[model samples]
Target: RFPRNVQLCVLSFLLPSDLAAFASTCKRLVSLCRRDQRLWFSMCHRRWGSQTLINKWGSGRISYRRLYRILDEYKNLIGFWRRCGDSAAPASSSPPPVFFEWGPSYIAGSRVFPSKNKGYDAMIEKPFLWMSVAWNRKAMNYLDSDGKFVLNEEDLIGESGFVENELIRVNVGKNKITYN
Candidate 1:
């Protein structure tokens, strides 16, 4: 990036396609390459424009120019992560905070009595995951059936045996919190 015509500099020094091969050739190179975002970016971005490369270059998106850009971004030597496959598991950039929430009804031994509790309406019951992806640091949290902040309310209820979740609800005159 220092030299104005530096675009041409990488060609003589490091070709894009050769970078991955070079990175694999030795440990030092791999370490350098890992720090170099150009290779990783190319590897990642290559998946994006496959059709364009085939139409124009008749090959992959690999090129020397992109490699230098990656080097510039990664040369400082910081952390890098490479995903081997589709990572479906939940991931967070930062460790989650120590959290405690209500335990589930199964652990609480409080079953919604359905028709037995005619005073209440058990019209519909289905489970869905509501996440608090908008936490203080933009993290994910889940909301339970009653639209509470905590996904599991068992901890909030403690060992007290409440038959229905609404019984403990702070709203609608159900604030009868009692512990077993």
Candidate 2:
């Protein structure tokens, strides 16, 4: 039989669905796969370690497995996106291109604009929205007003200003963005 460490290593490589199948094979593996912190932590770290601090995701209150699921669901939001729709505003008033990037505990969407410094190919980013996994494992999104991400509950304007649970839907395969 493989050592526990070796078994964990193997299990970490499997996708969540595959891991679930492996766990269903026997009771011992079910216990190991569901209860072992190391395995889930390893899976989360391996996937998103370079992008964000996996430990900071759920503030240590939730399991790494839940964190993995949350990040996996929202992984497609970590790239550049442009607004596509008819705007009543004039062409000059059109929204800027948005760049979504991973933060320590949230995915932040920023408005990308050419840098004020001339002759340099640098772009400036201003935070526009922040998305995070709430304590209940539901996705939460906060709109940034005044060019800063909301830090406190009081900073939220109203229901119309921010969305919860179903904020935005992204079709990565088709490069489409739908607001819900």
- Considering every candidate listed, which one attains the maximal lDDT? 2
The TM-scores of all predictions, comma-separated, are 0.19, 0.75
Q: Which stretches of candidate 1 lie over 4 Å from their true place?
A: 1-22, 48-180
RMSD of each: 20.6, 5.9
**Per-residue alpha-carbon lDDT of candidate 2 for residues 26-82, written as tens digits (9 for 90 to 100):** 998998988899999999988899998887665556788888888897788778887
Which pairs clash in the backbone of model 2?
Answer: none
- How would you encode candidate 1's per-residue C-alpha lDDT over 1-180 as one tens digit per residue? 255234323423554457668678778666555554454445433532332221112012334244334323322322222333345665653322222211221111111223545556642222222211111212122224443333243433322223234433221112222232
lDDT of each: 0.32, 0.73
Q: How well does candidate 1 match the true structure in TM-score terms?
A: 0.19
Best by TM-score: 2
